[model samples]
Structure formats: C-alpha cells, structure tokens
Target chain A: MTTTVCGRCKSSGAVTDHQGRQDGAVVWTILRCPTCNFSWRDSEPARAIDPAARSVDFAVDADDLQRYPKILQQ
Target chain B: MNDLPNRARSISSLRDFLELLEDSGQAITWSDPVMPEPGVRNIAVAASRDANGAPAIVFDNITGYPGKRLAVGVHGSWDNIALLLGRPKGTTIRELFFEIAGRWGDQEAQISFVPEAQAPVHECRLEQDINLYDVLPVYRINEYDGGFYIGKASVASRDPLDPDNFGKQNVGIYRLQIQGPDSFTLMTIPSHDMGRQIMAAEREGVPLKIAVMLGNHPGLAVFAATPIGYEESEYSYASAMMGAPIRLTKSGNGIDILADSEIVIEAELQLGERELEGPFGEFPGSYSGVRKAPIFKVTAVSHRRDPIFENIYIGRGWTEHDTLIGLHTSAPIYAQLRQSFPEVTAVNALYQHGLTGIISVKNRMAGFAKTVALRALSTPHGVMYLKNLIMVDADVDPFDLNQVMWALSTRTRADDIIVLPNMPAVPIDPSAVIPGKGHRLIIDATSYLPPDPVGEAHLVTPPTGDEIDALSKRIREMQLGALS
Candidate 1:
C-alpha cells in the first residue's frame, strides 16, 4: 500500500488509524492532515458504535479514502 | 548571561531581557520537538491565551533546524509588559499610561554606539550570499498567508535629509515577507514615516539602506511601534523609559541596529521598487489584501551565536501587537488630549489593536467629555485609527471592558451618541468603505450631573472590597471541581 500524504502540506507525514483498522469503515473521528492545525470530525454513522469497546485504531476512518481521494494512493 | 540584574543594568540588549525574563520566572523553554510554521504558532497562541498569561516560550528544538530556537509570547500578558516597563506588580492600566507620559517629556536619553568588535549581532556574519530561510526557520503563522512573515521586525532607517529628529533615529515595525533567497517585501503605508523615508531616498535616486533587527529587548519593539512624532527619535524615548541608554552598532549599510539584537538583516530598499506583498493576517483580525509594496534586497545577514528568532501572533484581540500598540499609543493619546482637557485622567486604547479608545475623565466642567472626544478625533495619531471614543467618568476603569459597557448602557443615550461620518480610517480597518476613509462614533458615557441643584449624582453599587475579598477567600478554600 502506498503511503498517505496530507493534502494540505503535501507531506507524507499523514498518519491515519484507519490505515491499521482491520475493518475499513468510516466514523466520527478526528482527521488531521498536512500543515494546518485543523482537525475535522467525520460525520457520524447511521448507528452509534460502542466507543468504549472500540480499539485504538478506530480513530482511522476508512471513509477518508473515498472522501479525500488524495488521502491514500494505490 | 550577564551577572547584573536586568533592571539594574538598564536592559541595553535583547540578551539582557532574556536573562531578566528567566530571573523573574517569565520565560519557559520547551526542549521538546516543535515543528516550524503552524506548529510553533499553534503552541504560541495557546500559551498566550493561558488564564495566567503563561511565561514567554522558547522552543529549543525546532524540528528541522537543529541548534536553532524561536521565542514568542514575550509581551503576552499585562504582567509581562509591566515587568518590562519596570512597573510594580498590579500596575493599573491608568498608571501605565501615566508611566509612559511621565517619561515621554524627559530629555532624550543617550544611545551608545558600540564598536563593531564588541557587537554580538555581528559575531557570525554572512555578507556575500545568504538564504534567509536556510539561516532561520521563517515560520508561517496563518494557514493561507502569502508566505512566511517577520512579524517582530524593527526596520531602522535614517531620513536621507535628516537622520534623526534633531538627532534621534527612526525605527518602525513593519511586516516583511520572504520572497526569495535575498529578497523581501516591506508592507507599509506610503504615508508612514518609514515609507516616507523610502520615498525620499527614492526621489533622490538613492537606495534607502534599512537595518532590520529581530529579537531585541521588548522595550525596543515598543519604541518601534510607537508613533513618536515625525521629529522625535523613538530610540531616545526608549532610552528614557528604560532609564538607560540603548546600545547600538552601525551595520554595513551604515544604519544603526540594536547592538544586542539576536539577528540583523541589512537590506537596501531600491528606488521605485514595488511588489505584491500581503493577504496576511493583520492586527485587525482580517487579511490585509494584497497590494503593491516596497521590495527590499538583502545585503547582509548577521546574528549572535545560537540566535533565537522571535515573532508575534497578530490576529484579533489581546495579542502582543494589540497590547504593545495599546500601551505604547495610549500615552501619546493621553498627552494629546490633556493639552485641551486637563480633566482627562487616562486613556485606554483597547480591542482591535487600538481601533477604539476609552477616555476616562473627571468631568470638572460641563460637556468636557464631548470636548475630549472632539480633541481625540482631531489628534493626528488618534485621527487615523481610533474609530470609537467612549468617554466615561473617572470612576470607571477603561481597561475593564465590562465597566465601560456598563457606563455606556446606564449613562449613555442615543441622542448623546455622536457620529462623525466620512472620517479617515486606518488602512487595515476592514469596515472602511475605502482603505483610509470611514465613519467614527463618539459615545458619551459620562453621567450628566447638572449644576444648580438639578439632581443628585447617580450611585453605582457593587460588592464591597472587603466582601469581595472574603468571598474570594471562601471560594479559594472550597474544594469545587470541574467548573470551579
């Protein structure tokens, strides 16, 4: 898999929990990219996930792959 | 570090100031990794906004630039500013205005010109070729800024005809954006003293040599930002305020730079040179739209060993820019008003980098507040940017925005509010219909105590000092959590 690049700064320093999530899915979590200090909360899924039981990687939402096409490259 | 106490030595240099800060528990060093650009600014903004107005931050570990450091939030709080001004703790804003005014009329203190061999700024000099970005991490504060900006710059230049106001130097704090390896644009209003000096040099077909000093004593920064009259030297005023002569070193360009500056960039501002310069966040909480500005060609870059770059967070209210402009400009405005209205006690230029001035007056005569408002509007300095003048009784604390608003709400009337239309405005004011034209509002918030047995004085009752202190003590002793 190609490394993800932050769309803003165009730096390869972009790291996403979804990159390590076993089940690739999008949820409400912080998406920080590039140079700007802004981090947006992904829209909530139709059903709320058990936040307590969710693993650490749950912060990475796979939906970013489609929403931000440049977030990940093959 | 020098062995002398900062105040005792007269704070002749920036390093002296750093030592002073360290001694007074006003400085904090961050050895952890901090990225340039947004990262440093992010931490600075957060730290400045701390409840107690946290100490100035020094980032020792700049991620890409090893051994290079950056400092910010030096003037982040009133306490810090008071400390630099040599004022006692809990110095009221009114006292600050008086402090500046009381020292303003003193004899122009001396400035010592140190030999080049003794100047630390030239310890490590690069004259032939230098890239500013390579030498220092020019961090970008705003996300959409045109480029990295030198927010804390003291660009010194001499009037081609008159080097000083009868012997005082002219130094100004203007924004400079790094355009190339050795090129930067100076964004200043054409009418400003610095801009006028450049134009004068240009008309003479002579390049204006400017010595841009960075990371100097906070006193120097205040002096640079002050509108110390066209004929007066800001350096003398700084020396007088600091109670000591400032040390200066002549740069390669023959311009005087602060002897103890962390870094000095000597540049030649060419005649008739213009470049697109802004779209950067300004003190007005708005982006100063891009326009043609003077371009400066770098001639030399010099600095002390292990220099620390300093920058200001310029945006909205209560930033270093606001605090400096407020404290620095208030005294002049007070002096200007006191000439006409002696009843004027103090002036607080607050909110939006001194766009508004709250003048507290004792109101010895009828309608004196309105007269003060008129005088302030006509004064040269206040005429430019003071769009609103709120006149309150001396009982009200102009620095306390709440008290000011209460006076306006209780004692003011719509009829009492005077509006002057089509006045000159600061170029950076976003609400201006044009760059330098706008309207002004003069709100007379003073109580109308008519003479000849008309009515009794209105009483404003609040918590007594003893009661307030007891309550504060009780609250302090309480074990409240969360919202406490």
Candidate 2:
C-alpha cells in the first residue's frame, strides 16, 4: 500500500534495547519502521548467536552489588 | 518476494531511529545549548551506577550544525529497557532473561526506495562528497577516542555461501570507524554472528550485501547488538515485547530493503580483505585495541524523509552496550538457570569492575548451591563474561549490589568456595581468565545448612500491603532511629 510514513513513525528504531516485557518476559527484538512508525517485538534466536557453551567471563561491579542491599542475602 | 520494494534499512541510521523514539514516548527533546560532545553523555554517566538508569536526551541546537539533531541516553533506565522489550515499566533483569532464553527470532527487515520518491533525509544532502566532519556535529565523547568512531551499529547482510541462511538474516550491531564520507572500516568483533556471516561469505568468495542501520528506537539497537542464538530473529523478539509486528519499508537499490528503519547505507564486503579500524572506547570501559579489519564500499545510501543519524556512546561503567549486555544478554542467562533450578532467583551480569559475579539462589542441597554456580558458567551469557561467580540465597536479588556483597561478607568461606581458573573470555573482561581464556572460581556464598536447617527463604513473606507500608513509614517518619 502506497502511504506516506509519518515523520513520527520514521523517527528511529521503534523501542529501546534490552527492555523488560510480559509479566515475566524479556525484550526479544525491538523494531520500528519510521514510516507508519511501525514498531514491534520478536523473540531473540537462541541457536544462532552464542551457539555453544562458549566460555566467557562476567565482571562483577562491587558497587552494582552494593546498591540494593536489602534484597541481597547474607 | 512480497513485491513493492522493501528497501533494506541498515539497522544503523541515527535519523530514522529518532522517529521511533518520538512515537514510543521513550524520548523527549531538550532545547538546551549543545554541550561539548563528550560532555553530552554525562546524563548517562550520571546514572550508570545502576543498569537501565539513564534518561534519553535530544540536542536541538548544536554549536555548528544550526538545525541538525543529536540523541543520547536511548536505553538508560530499566523501565526504558523494559520499554525496549515492549513490556510495562519496572521489568527487572531476571524477567527479561526468561524471555531471552525462549528464542523466537525475526526474518529480515529491509528497506526499498524509488529515485522519484523525495525522502526527508534529502532535505540537505551534501551535493558534493562532504567531509563527515562538515555535515554533522560529530562528538569527542571521550579524550581517548583516537578519532570519531561511530561506535554503535546494527548491521544486516545475507550469507553469500548458503542460500538457506538468506531469508532469516539477523541485524547485528557493532562499531564503525568513520574515516571519510565514501569509506569506513568495519569492526565486527571476532566470532560475532555478523562477523561470522561476513567471514562465511568471504571464505566462499561471494559478496556480502550490507545495510548499516544508523539510528532508531534505542531499544532495537540493544536487540541488534545482543548475542542471542541465531535461530530466531531479534526483531521478532522485539515484536513479542511490543505486542505487535515491527513495521518496515523499502530503500536499498537491491531487493533486500528494510522495514521500519531510520536509514540504510548499502555496501558490499568481500571476504578475506582486512583494514585497521579502531581505538574508540569499547564496552569493556577500555580502549579497544586496533588491528586490520574489513573495509566495505558504500554502493548507495537511502533513508526516510528527515533521517536523524544514530550514535551510541562507549565509556566507563555504562554505555548502551553495557546496558544491552546486562539487561538483554545477561538477564536471560538467569532465566535459563531458573528453568533447571527454580530457586535460582536473580542474576546480574556486572561490568568488569569487580569483574566477577554475584548470583542469588536458594540452596536446596548442601552441594546444590555449587551446582548452580557451575551451571551458571555454562549459560550463553554467563560463559562469555564471568570469572568468579558468587552464588547467594533467594533472599538476595542478584540485581541489588549491596545484598550480594553482604552475602559475600557474611556467608562466604574462602575454602568452601571452588575456583576453576582459566576459561575463554571476551577481550574486555578485566577478570577474564587466561586474559581471554582462563578458569573462574565459584563461591558458594548461600547460607549453607547452618546448625540444623530453616525452611527455604522463598517461603518467607512476613507481611503484605498496608502493614508493610505502615512499617516503612514508621521507620522513616517516626523517631525510630534507636529501634533501627
């Protein structure tokens, strides 16, 4: 259908990155047309990236752990 | 196949990406004077203490570019991160991981355009090949940023080798080195899906068609750059979060146009060629080492009417990459573990500061906690960025920094915890084993069977509603300092 994309729709990618969703869902994919400003979601593929149990490291920021103390258990 | 040119969007257009922000309500404009480029990211720097804590900013009037626009702080808050996930606000990292673990990816979002169509981005196209420095207000984000490296990108291309890999192409976001208008260097981190795709095409002696998505919904960029499995499309995950399908359009001169994108810069990367690309601040909060990388030649550039080019900042503690990794990438790892062990409560993929890990899980058995710690190293995200992974009880939300430290302070016994040195790690992880490949130790910090045993902590909810509220108010408003 030939329709002009409203400037608002053509703004940017529809959503932000790594957003939370569902009652317990994570952001799968974030999209936007910038035309109809058509934006939506899609699940992240599990088999494609990070395919194997590849070894990597997780850097712990002490401050990040210290910020919300109450929920942290002893 | 679905007629009516669907020009492929480059997954990295700053201009087209902006329109998505205005429509989503995740961004707002500020009429403030353009702060110096590096100074602009302070908004995020100010809030990096916590993941998903920055606010998006738009610069209306810059020092040089009279009317051009610049956007910052795209994926700043957890709620905003949730917004990117298309979820109601306040979504936590744990919840996001559950969804990520369940992978359902998107096909391809392409953009198609006709010469007759006048797009807004054309309003001021530089008639002559202008220096990138002249057309836009480039920033000097950090002093060490050797030069202007457009740090964030969501690139898409088809694997020339296997036609089967075509259709389900993914959008991968990485960094780019903006050298001159016609040329730029591609810095696809090794083993990255996009890098793998290019390598595959080149290995077979084929041309890799590419679209560099400039800017758009900041959330989408997170999905683009994320290291999810390749089975599903990132856009589909985005769609699931938004509760709808992302709209797309056509723009590239070829058949692969993008849907609902900001702008698409088409180029072809032939395999096996290499060129040097970076010195920009990387996600590790350190300057990425430079080396020979692939160089692509732009065949054509297309965008929606008034395209706002997209840019992402990289610096200490937090950047869009860190947030994307933590929220979109790390959270899902927690969910995966939770599936096997329901008591595995929370997960936080910390930046490379402490450069270790703090996990919270209810200890069901004496060694159950350790098993959880070991399994953590196996999750997709965990294996990629952990050195010393600390396991805590359900009482802790791995997200709360203080809670985890308290566990380390009180419950952790150095001898009881296990340390496995030398394991593969990303280049930036400070505690990365082997500098890149070494083993990490796991600390079983959850309160072990102390004395006898207490019922699982998950079964402990002392109060509800008004009673809890009244107690908090009493603590704050009443002279209950002595009681505290």
Candidate 3:
C-alpha cells in the first residue's frame, strides 16, 4: 500500500480512498483529505504488480476534467 | 477629516484597477487565439483557481472579435480585493469588511459631472441597428443557462416621487438577462431599493427609467452592490472611497452614468411589462428556476471605440459574484450592528454563497452575542436573503470556514439555536415554502459562561509561527510543476 499526502493541508497519512473504479487503461480514484476536509480525484496507469512489489505514491492528484464532480454542491 | 492614506481609500476606475493588478504581477494577459465557447470561461476559471484568487485574467485575442478583449476574475479573490482596497497582501475578507463598516457613515464625497463629449463611454453612440450579440461576444459559462447574462451589470434608478431623495439614485448590481437585442429582463426583488423605486414610479403613473452600466471601475461596482440607505448615493460612496470625485455624464434620458465605463445600455421599465427571466446560474452555485420578471426596453446603446466586455463567473462557490454580493451585504450589515453593539469586530456574509452570515464580536455582556445575531437578521441587507446567522467570539475569523466550523462544533448547542419561521423569504431559495416566506435560524456560538477558575486549556496546536513562515518561504521559492 502507498501513502499519499494531501495537497491542501500538506499532511501525510490523512487521505483515504472514497471510491475507485477501473476504466479500460486507467484506474480512477477519489481521495478525501481528513485534515482539510477536501476531496480530489486521481488516476493511474493500469498495470499488474507482484504482491511484494513496492508501490509509488503521488504528491498531487490527477488533473482530469472528466473526474471532477459535475455538480459541486455548496 | 480623512484618516486613511489616499491610496488606501479607493480605486479610480476598472481600467485603473486592472493596470494596478498588472503592475503588481497579480494579473495575467492571454494573447493566444481562443473561442468564446468553452475556452475563455474555462481558462478564466482555471487560472483563478490555480492562482488561488491571486491573478485576474484578460483575453486579448478572442477568436471572432480580433481587437476586442474580455476580462474576468478581476475581483474574484480576497487578495485582489485587498489590493484594490489598498490593504496588505494577506488581509482577510473579514478584515476588509470591518474596514468598510468603519468607514460606512463618512460624509459623502463630491462628484463631478462632465459633458457627453468628454466621456469615453459616449465615443460611439449607436442609436439604430444596435445588435448586442454582434457587437460583444457574451459567453455562456453554464450549459443550462437560459441565455447570455449580464452578471456584473450596475443598474441605476431613482425615486421619482420622493422629493427628499431627489438626485439620490440607487445603483445596484443585479442579474440581467439579454432576452433580445432591444429588450432585457431584470431580477429585482420587491424588498430591494430598485424594486421600491419601480413600484413608486408605477404609482406616480410614469415608467421607471433605468440605466445599466458595464465595465466601470471595480470600486463603483462594489459601491453599487452595497445596500446602503435609500437616501444615499452609491456614486458618492465610491468617490469617498477613491478619495477623488468620480466623473459622470448624463445619458440621453438624463440618468447619470460613469464617464469611464466601457459600455452603457439606457433603458426604461414599462409598467405591466413582464417576461420570463431566469433559469440562469446564480451565485448559490445552482441554476435559479425561471420566473416572471419585469422586462427593460433598450432606448439607446453607447460604448467606447474598442471596449472590453467584462463578465463575472457564476454557478459556483468562490466565484467573483459571491465575493461581490458577500462583501456588499456584510459591510453595511456590520455598520448597522456596530451602531448597537460597538464590540462587533468583523462579519463574513460571504459564507455559503452569502445565505449564511458569521459575525465575530468581543462579547462584553452575557447575552450580547444573541443580541448581535438577532440584530443581524433584522437589518435591511440581512433580512433579505440571510437565512442562517451565527455569532462567535472575536478570536475567531469569520472568513475562515475551518474556524467557523470549529466554533459551531465547540461553542454551539442545539438548545441554544433560535428558529424563527414564516419570515420574509428569499425569492431565489429553492427551499422556500412559498414565494416570499421562509424560516430563519440564529446560532449563538459565543461562550456564555465565564472563564474557568484557573484558565482554559488550548486543545489543538498549530505549527509554530516561525515554522509556518519558513514553510511559506520554501513553498514560494519552489517552482510550480506543470499540470496536465
């Protein structure tokens, strides 16, 4: 498992996966930051890895328009 | 007696504010060719968000209109507003509101009237064949919006019958929809000054003459958005803030307009003329359902030789429209609250698309917080659309949502919440029981009991001040990575 740092609060280990889905060649995920209570979306290239392989964490979320919430409720 | 420095008072015009932003490296100019659809609004929103409201955007080479430019996000952020108010870079929105409230009752400043020949807005007058859609590229931000919306329009009107209010015109910023080239629909609530003026004009058997000015100084827009007394002039307030007289020219119909404005649409609202107005995206980040509104018939259109069309992005939180409306309501309401409770420090009406108001005050008495909260709901500005009013201690910054939420969680109790039903309603609220009636809530988040015997303990610990300064400097030094 990889640990991600939140971009807003800059706190590590405070992010959790809200949802994840596989879309053809990419794996899309929505991550929520508990420190700032903000959510962002991310995507990674789909690949197969051994159970013992080390996972790389990303410092920022993926900037994809499709992954953004269509209606941002206030 | 002027207490503040001259530069800290007010800005001259919208162009002057843009120039100041460019000089301070707070504005970005886009020269690349782009279409009005999807491209202009997309880049404006992205640039504003990326900069965290630090930069205003100007699109110079729009696809169809080669020389004509469009500017947005000029007043989109707290930093830009602080700069415009001549405050420090890190000034909070609450602090700005306090300043405006402190200066709210200052004597009116003098304004100069210039002839039409001297006004830049009258450089090109189109009395015939005034095609608005062809002249300016009014882009649509939302896919479901009814049509092109003049989101930042400053509409001017006056009371024709009241002799005491002679020459005191109310300039308000309301959502205007372009129904046709020669006609428009204005969303004016009955409680607003403009609505009252319209009703007064109708009673006197005269059509309410109105003038909508666009692309003036940001200061003028701010003054117009504010709900000052009906007997006051928004132009005079703007002039006082600027520390200089604002130049104005009479329109063809005799209504005064900003001489430095980019465009002016002179129109009159005929009695008994109503049309379908909305379904346009409002500041609440939602589309206000369509409703019947008074239609404005355009009499004449005037503009500069090459004018820059201005628009404020709507349909979301943290947009320019919210900032404008929030500040306008907060400042005047704060002034009113201070009249009875001088301990009030700051107010944040920009909370939750301005439907919620968070006011912080230095509580000297036990029930002072409740008094302030109730007074906030009774003000003319507050009674209109402020549905949720919360009061907190002076230590809390109302503009910071995190602090406000902390206060709500720690200081508020369910038993202490005051619920008043069947109050005057906000027409745009989707949850209103009827057209003009709704419930009001007041949350007294301030501490009621005395301090602990020894001392109250601080629960949460933030980073040290020095550490925060070092982190900020390090982040400033690092180059931003490219985004996809």
Clashing pairs in 3: B13-B217, B14-B217
Tens digits of per-residue lDDT, candidate 1, B1-484, equal 2333257337766667767777778788989876564578788778767523457888877655667778888777765676677764345565666677787677557788889878998999998867786576556666545456899899888778666433445788999987656778888765578877777777777667788999986788987787767777777777877677788888888887788899999998866756545557888888776555677899999999989898888775557676666778888888878888888888887567568889999987556788888888777677687898899999888877998998988888788888899988987899998877999999889887655233536685776455775676466557444346
**Clash total of candidate 3:** 2
User: Which residues of candidate 1, in runs, are more than 4 Å off?
Assistant: A1-74, B1-9, B88-90, B163-168, B451-457, B460-484
Top candidate on lDDT is 1
What TM-score should be assigned to candidate 2?
Answer: 0.69
DockQ of each: 0.02, 0.01, 0.01
What would the per-residue lDDT of candidate 3 be over residues B281-353, giving only the tens digit for each residue?
A: 7766766755556778888888887787888887766677666556777887778888988899888887544
At residue B42, candidate 1 shows an lDDT of 82
Encode model 2's per-residue lDDT on B278-329: one tens digit a residue.
Answer: 4457666766544456767666665555455556666775565566556555
Ranking the candidates on lDDT from highest down gives: 1, 3, 2
| Cα TM-score of candidate 1 | 0.81
lDDT of each: 0.71, 0.54, 0.69
